[model samples]
Target: MQSNDGPAIDETSSSSSSSSSSSSSSFSSFSSSSVTVTITKLTTNKRKSMLTVNGYEFHFKDYNKAKTIKFLRCASRNCGILLHKSFSDEFVRFSGKMTDHSHLPNTAALGIRTLREKLRQRAEHERLPLQEIAEQEVRAGLLTGHNLLHNRRKLMPPLPQSCDFNIPDEYRKDYLNRDRLLLHDSYDPQFQLHESVYKRPEGRTLVWSSDVQLKLLFDSEKLYMDGTFCTAPPNFNQVYIIQVIHHETFKLYLFH
Candidate 1:
């Protein structure tokens, strides 16, 4: 028999109590597992900070803040395929070191002298005109000498004065006389003929043709004449006489 002060427990109520206890235990296990995962995350981040590749230490501080590494195919003409990519800093440093002045060959020091000697020999072998080669040699010698003199602290000589000699009276008189004779000799009869033939008319005259038929008719009968003149003794005057011939009889008539 049941006691009067206590409530009787049902099967369903007992099962419900067991399920709630199981759920509480599972929740505690999950929380503890999360703590271990957070520790692993921290360790992984620390390892990442010490990462290295191909024996080169990764120093982010040496790089500019805005700089970024690019993955480009190798740009060498012989190896354009994607061999590797590099940071711009490393590439620029490598290029600059390769092109440093100390890397130049020893022969480059005497390059100009060697080139000049070779050219001189070649010019001689080809039997080129000596004057041209001499001029070139003189120019090269002058430039080389100037450079040497400048390096030694020597001053250049002053240029020659342009006005050095006085003109003699007899020479000046001969030059003037020769020029006057040349001028007098150049005034020939042919120039006089051209001047006479192409003289400007005394006054301007205007002739207008109206109709096409009339123009054609006048042009059919039109004649052209030309003549030449020669200089006379007393004066420079010359004359040219021009005549138009009649179309029917070919008789010449002086044009007004």
Candidate 2:
């Protein structure tokens, strides 16, 4: 059964050569127009699906499940440009008028959005460290200094408002599907230090160590413990580190 909502595709008789030629011509025209639109699917910083038609960007606004259609609106604040797209198992077609953007196409913004998405995906899936992922992105793409902080905030998790805030699962591990790096977490709201001014625990203690570090610590005979206040992160006062001196290798290895 043919669906009434979609455009009817004509079937040509094999015996009629003229009908086949006309159908072929119509298909060629449709294919050429589809090439002109140059639709690129991309992800926004907020991880939303977006589409770029020609040079203008549009955000997914709504979907009509009954008709298998998706509606999109211009990314601009007040732009009236709208688009409709139909999808099926075989093909995707865009309806309504395209190239009717209210403002000049921002190719720079589109490029940045693409780069950010690439970085986000690499951070999640790639075994490389975040610094390496960012360095690779900078070498591959052109980035501007003006939006550095904005992009950083998008990639990093929000700072906890208080010590009682829960940490996300991703932060507890070194990478996706990798072994946990957070070795110890001692958070006590009622725990207090001996200092007279400090009545309650303002921040908790945390220790991070990797598998290799643990192996080195286990193999070493002598261990050294040191504490530093200068390099401590915000919300924490000091960083206590443990270093091991391996007997066989005769090398110093810092674990945490």
Please tell me which predicted candidate would have the highest TM-score against the true structure: 2
Candidate 1: what lDDT?
Answer: 0.28
Q: Mind sharing the TM-score for model 2? A: 0.38
Q: List TM-scores for all candidates, in order.
A: 0.15, 0.38
C-alpha displacement of 238 in model 1, angstroms? Answer: 96
Query: Candidate 1, residues 1-256: lDDT per residue as tens digits?
Result: 1112212211111110010000000011111111111000000112222111111111222222333432222112233121111242222111111211211122222333344444556675868787777677667656576678786665433332422333233322222232111111112332233545566333221111223323333555565555434542122233333333444544323321
**Candidate lDDT (C-alpha), each:** 0.28, 0.58
List of clashing residue pairs for candidate 1? none
Show the colliding residue pairs in model 2. none
Name the runs in model 2 displaced over 4 angstroms: 1-35, 88-99, 142-256
Backbone clashes in candidate 1 total: 0
